[model samples]
Target: MQLSNIAHGPEIRDEAVAFCLWAPLHQRVTLKIEKRGQWQMKRLADGWHRVEIPGARPGDLYTFILPNGLEVPDPASRFQPNDVHGPSEIIDPTFAWRTEPWNGRPWEEMVIYEMHLGAFTEAGTFLAAIEKLEHLRRLGITAIQLMPLSDFPGRYGWGYDGVLSYAPDSSYGRPEDLRSLVDAAHGCGISVFLDVVYNHFGPDGNYLPHYAPIFSDTHKTPWGRGLNFDGAGSRFVRDFIIENAIYWIREFRMDGLRLDAVHAIRDDSHPHILCELAERVREAVSERPIHLIAENEDNNADLLARDAQGRARQFTAQWNDDIHHVLHIAATGETFGYYRDYAGDGAKIGRALAEGFVFQGEHMPYRGKTRGRPSTGLPPTAFVSFIQNHDQIGNRAMGDRMNASHPIEAIKAIAAIYLLAPQIPMLFMGEEWGSTDPFPFFCDLADELNETIRAGRKEELSRLPGFDVNDALDPICESTFRQAKLQWRGAIHNEPFVEYYRLLLSLRRKWIVPCLADARGHSAKYDSDGRLVCVTWKMGRSILHLMANLSGEAVDTTVPNRKDIILSQGDIAPDRLGPWAVLWSLAQE
Candidate 1:
């Protein structure tokens, strides 16, 4: 895999350990080991400083003193015992994997469950999460998509604002603890996928810019300066990012990675950084199925293209926000912001189900631009659909879930459609039992940055309907972070929702997953009349049909004549679908 070429940070050997740092702007770099003697790093021609310490064992705390006397953690640090501003800890990557070697499950078998480590349980630790793996395995979740774990400043933050890309956040647990969580999940027959943010570092505690050419002046992202992926000194930057992806796959034995916001990653190289990273990761781990998913707002179907053998050419699938928008509007009828473009558009709901995207080459009024390319050529598995994810729920004025705002029937109808659809399905944490507890945006940062974020969040929420800035939760407050935690007690009261999800997922495993491996694009058709949606897919030799009435009133629609009924939600008469009703049936040709 040529992992040696991409190695950075501290490398432990049999008797000697080597430390490497890329500090192009600095002429001298000093390695400061805690309670140990310091050593001057030798400079290389390509801006890298290196030093080897014999008998330097694991559990050593160290930092690099720059030319300006500023101490900073390793850009590729494996673990941060303290926070981001603290010294990096050298970790022994080797672990006695308790589980037998696992090659990962197929992409079609994935029923993903997205979770935030901090809010997933009361303990908010990796080992604490391991205790719930059996519950997930029984719930039919083949993959557990964890939120980002990179080291961010302060106590807590959505991991998108992470600085040390390679270090797992200390707030959750140590690097070895994370490995234990993965090993434990695999033991329970569940794959672990991590969400990673590579577009930009957090607002605070990022020291790469002081020593290396990390950001490009030629490009900018919404967050700030974009990463240097195509500039003059971009080869090393590309290597750093690509190596981070491979490190998680090889070191942590992660089954996959969900690249957060690839659209924000600005790179004009011959092969984009996204493409390069995927290729490198695949090369690094060819023995097992290592899936790479993207959360791109651009809806670029080209990235999810399949080869002649129906294998992904680059990314395995994308988080389809289009389907979520359409389904959310159908359930709640909220038309503010981006939802306005999809509101009352029954055709979009049909297209999102039958095809992969709704805005393919169409003008989106919300963004004031033409969004998305043709996605009908790709397989249905190219899109991952979800009704409520972190962003959709947390970004709101009050992190209100779909169940909190809409009727249970409405939420269940939408769940029935997506959970049993041909596309990959993902459930946010606590969604199975109709959790009403909000998953609001919460972070702990410097006082000044916290105030700035709080004000900005208020201003953004004021634009939404019925939002009051005065009533908004302070994101930096410790109480707000605690408020987002999942309440397991609610599961007992909402057992019906759990059973509903289990039934749908079990049907998906038995009927849908087997045909998905050979499923192709442009093999589905749909018809929507007012509030009624009917879609049919030709999955291999089997025909899967879906019919639903998403409104409060009953709608008359012709039911497909197939006795192989998988599920029927609400009342489905011979010629009419009752309010919030959904029906699914499969017939073999």
Candidate 2:
């Protein structure tokens, strides 16, 4: 359980290399070295095959050969220098870490900036991304959440389809390059978090089924068969995932991991995989702050709650879709699909601001079921609220961002509310300055699979009311990927919006962040007209008020204590707000 010597990958030593694997079903297993022949491995006591090569050293390529003469890449491969279908490479984990004794920033102090490495810069490599760390630091970002780096079978992807769980994508630079990027981020006082997929493997190049019963035929996910967690032979499968969680934090020195989707990880056992993972990750860190964030569509507030005996559950924070959905509806007034429930009537958005989730035991027509549980007593920091994230943008038919459909003032108002809210805020890459580039859905699949995915996307969009299937970009096109790249100069040209963001973030850091430690100190109220919502925060008599107007016309309403106004946008009158305006103020008394 310590994962010190019990790791399941190729371990390199000075004189001899020990390779360990969990292949209980196979009676005979061989370690096939590239161009160096093969060696039979002896089965160990705990259903793992073990082999030690005397002359093996770092940078060696190896694969596990099963009894059926099928050579498969290591399920726990650390470096897939070749594609996912090729042999795994041995990586020298030794790096001169400059930030020794690096205690990461506290969870409450994080203002995360979610980025896609390939689209973040023109170079689109790990080393190239290092140059932008200073720019992020200057923007007051405390953490950088990299989209999944695990190697998938493609030239590029949103990174959700990663099959080689341990290997960083070879399309990006080498393993050392990723380490260098982390090192540089640490040097800039930015904590690095990796987004890891645990629910299901990719469609193409997935060889897990060849080695063991890792997938459950009984349970399925949107991608395919759900991973084996509760069924027979599940202990090893669960261990595989838990070990991966530990590997990222301990080996990569990542401050935390953003678990891709917990709803898909089906487990009905006592002390669920989510709870076990949290416990194990805490034990592995041994006091260093390592955050675990979950992306759960269920809006289960208990994921962030403490149990009856006062033990932590699920994760440190959950992706609050309620917040994003309300903001989206308030901005665009698009009432189709899931957005139908969030009609921008002010009650739903107000509830989300007050208690973290709006659908707390309420019937949701979109899914035709009652959704969410009450989260009133939980800490505000337990939820991660974002105006725009990768899924909300890239998963769209056309991969359009928040600015694509909403007015500039409306976008600014929503961004202001999210940043100044008590919960942790996350900004999508290029969102600060309203980049015009569309973060369209793009992936690299085989020729046949590519055609199938393209057709499937068109069909999915055809069902949606407002979507124009013809406008959707080809997911397999090279031009689609290039079109999503950020134009950094957009930040310069959109200076007003950039300054608005910088000012609100600075104000939140100075005033709002201090109040987030106490959950009971925050409250929200919305006008009956469904156009204005005011969120108030109090930390030992220090009161901060944020008022936002979601209407399309000016509102003749009294300013909520404008004397101590710190930040104001759009038409700011003494007792009125212009269309799509916002005000952040503090109580003088």
Candidate 3:
């Protein structure tokens, strides 16, 4: 078989299969057909040659012959066994998907619910995640952004360290299973946005270096070797990564992709990988709109900017960590890592509302550098804001939640600000009702990768405020996933939390005042010494003022008594709410 000339994913003939092998010093390589037994083929002169195998179709198993004559499974196989040592399964992407014309929700309308497939349910499979879609839909969520599901080694993982780009993590079920989940999510009127990692591959089960020069030794990232986007003979490597992105969106009928850690892509090409990927994806739609949301930290609005042409350039949106860090730390009082820079009473929250980013060009004491660029024109909706996401909850030393860290009323106040703000609000899986689970980081890896992860996690986490790697990877024996599961019954039994969430969702749909910022003046006000904050949400013709106190002590102030009092934080504050107070009112006559 011809290694380089072998038929690839889309450009394939039924009878032709190109076998790829990386001997680095090999003269010639051949493919060994492993249908029941091994069948050797003749070698070519130029390191690769092709011969049509008449009967070898999608299901027939195959391996490649090394220059040393050792045979191994297809290193870049779309499916793999339980571990790296296991057999590589043949997968055909021609499975039926029901969400053919699913073109994702608009950026302004997205209320994302971030979730981990494994810990999302007891089964932790694609089918398992499907069972809870109705809850998310009824909760006013427009999209489901799943954590990385790229196939990785071992039993369970967070899916970020996925090694195989094209394969869905078999630990979470098969390729068809993921397709069914996306199809089912679309059926429930919820778009599925998958989180994909293109910056770097997982440490384990990564065979790209074995078959091709996919990783560049030129520059190193925190996650080891960065992808060889612009290197010698890097055409195939670039195509491989981009094809994988297209595969998930097209093959599984995924509505969009939340590209993980795009800031690390570090491509210096004229047309960057991100821009190229975006162009091709929209073109593939043929008439449908596809979404590409970047999980970027650069804070450069140009990442979502459009060129002279009116094409949909850049990503649909990006994950705004500053907003959450500022608001969450203000409410929960956890000032460890980046949260240390967000202790401006309610001024931080106010700033985030007026501008989508809180730390835009601010000197960050934590990173010891000024972070983010000036994004004066960007709308708040382009950045997904949340009081709690998987990263925030999981990074905790003991996996404690904001609820466990602060009074429930404080959490409610945080919730009110995010839901009432102009930006799209996202909720971690159990964040709505305030689940008590600690989303501690855990991963199942092959022994080689597992040890690397443990050591690497230790080194990386040492920089965090109080993270202990030993405590984080404690075998998941403490029912970490169970604790993270959304206690549906608690939605009713825990009436206060339930009501708080319901009020937010209801207002998100009905509160036209905050629905859109229009041709009017808008700003968030703070009390005499920055103890309380009041935001005026004004569209073209609608306007309402939302107020909340972020301090422990309350002060008497001239709150507008002329307007209609629409909503309050809780029953405890019939007269005045102290810790976490919220209210909405219009200008009185």
Candidate 4:
């Protein structure tokens, strides 16, 4: 279990602790311990400053003073006690094991439930989230994918604009509290995953540009300058990002990482940063199964390719937005923006179900260019399917859930289809009980920056239908953050929706999971007649079938005859399928 020297931060020696800082731009660097004497750091040749402090223990607050007299926290700080701009706290990484060593569950058994820590509960703390683990376990969720925990500015945000890559947000309790949450989850037989952003740092509180060459001059992303992955001073930059991924998996004991928007990561280096990060993480942990999921809009199948042994070569899976787009349009008929590429195309849904992507090297009118590569070579497990997620719900003009405006029957029909499909299934927070609580994009930053965000959000969503500027919530408002919190009391009355999800998950575990390990790529055949989508997958010796009519009128479609009926929503007759009807069955191949 060798670790990388790129693990930059305070490292506790036998008696004294060694602190290292990578400041290439600075010739003189000083380490300042709060209420203690300041020490001059020795400069190393590779742009790193080193200092050793005797009698320095955990809980000591420290910061680095550059030659220009500006202070900055450690880029790899383990914890921040007082937000992003505050001092970094020394944390003892030791934790007592309450459970036996968790080897982690197989990827085939993953039923992911994505959640935001701040909005997951009223308390919005890691300890508070531990209280709800039992509820998720009972709901048959094998994996809990936590939204980003990296420290961001102010009180609340989606965790995407995180400046401190290593520190968990101080707003959500201490580092030990997060460890307890993960320990408790592992004790309950649930794998914990973390969402991580490495493409670019947040807009505010990022002091890297002042001290280090972290951004590339040639490349730019949607969020402005991209990280220096293939630039002149990129070796250390790539090492920094790769080590962050390793630190999360090795130190925090996270079972996996959901890389946010990997398409934005531009690297021309051989053995790209994505590849190197995956390889290093796999090398660091071998006792447990470590899954790496990506949110790549490019629909690049090469990232999710498998070896000859049927194991993933790089990433384990990706968030399949194609299936989500087609399903959303079928349910709500809203075809604005990217949804236009999938609107009125029932075959796109079939392709997303059987194959992974709908636009596999095909022209997408929305992007005005060809999008995605061939994805049919990948297994269905390589894609994760979901009806609603944070981006899908929060990115809307009103931040509304599908259940907020669509019919219950329509939502249930899509749920039955994806929940039973061969691909992995993920649920947004409070989605199991048909929660309509709006998870609008909320953030707290400087007043000037907040105004910019407010205006930007309004301008971006103003073109969409039914968007009213007067009704739009200010993203900077504290009340906007509170509005996104989950209301647990609403679930008490939504028992039917809860039961439906539980039943679908239970059926998946019993009927689908057992055959998934042997599931192969290009083993599914699908057909669609505008609205009626029928797909069949060859899972081992069993044949799994799905018939869905996403139209308002009943369709005269022949239903496949299978004695082992898994589940059915709406009317399913011999020759006529009711509006919004979905039927799933299994039979001998």
CA lDDT of every candidate:
0.90, 0.83, 0.68, 0.90
Q: Is candidate 1 or candidate 2 better by lDDT?
A: 1
Minimum summed lDDT over a 10-residue window in model 1 is located at: 1-10
TM-score of each: 0.98, 0.95, 0.88, 0.98
lDDT per residue for candidate 4 within 1-589, as digits (tens), equals 2334645889987798899988889898999999887999999877889999999989999999998889999988888888889889998999886867789999999999999999999999999999999988988999999999999999999999999899999999998898999999999999999999999999888888888899999889988999999987788888888888988998889999999999999999887899999998999888889999999999999999899888999999999999999999999988877888798768889999999899999999878899999988788999999999999998876788999988988999999989999999999999999999999999998777977898889887775655676688788888888999999987788988888999999999999998897786338989999989989898778888888999899999777764777887899898989999998888875
Show model 1 residue runs off by greater than 4 Å: 1-6, 462-466
Better model by lDDT: candidate 2 vs candidate 3: 2
Candidate 4 TM-score, true structure as reference: 0.98
437-527: candidate 1 lDDT, tens digit per residue:
9988888888779778887788788767656778878898889988999999887788877888888899999988987866953399998
Count of backbone clashes for each model? 0, 0, 4, 0
Sequence-dependent TM-score of model 1? 0.98
Please identify which of the two predictions, 2 or 3, would achieve the higher TM-score against the true structure: 2
Candidate 3 lowest-lDDT run of ten: 1-10
lDDT of 2 by residue, 1-589 (tens): 3433467788788798899877777878999988788999999775788999988878889999999888889888988877898899888888999887688888878999999999999889999999888878878898999999989888888888899898999988898899999988998989999999989998888887876788886888888899988888788888888888888888888999999888888887877888888889888787778888989888787788765533346588888999999988888788877888888587778778767898988899878999988888666788899988888887677888868766887888888888987789999999888886889888998787988889888987776667788889999998899988888998889888777778878888887776665444444444446877776655446666767788898888778655688778788788888888888887634
Which pairs in model 1 have colliding backbones?
none
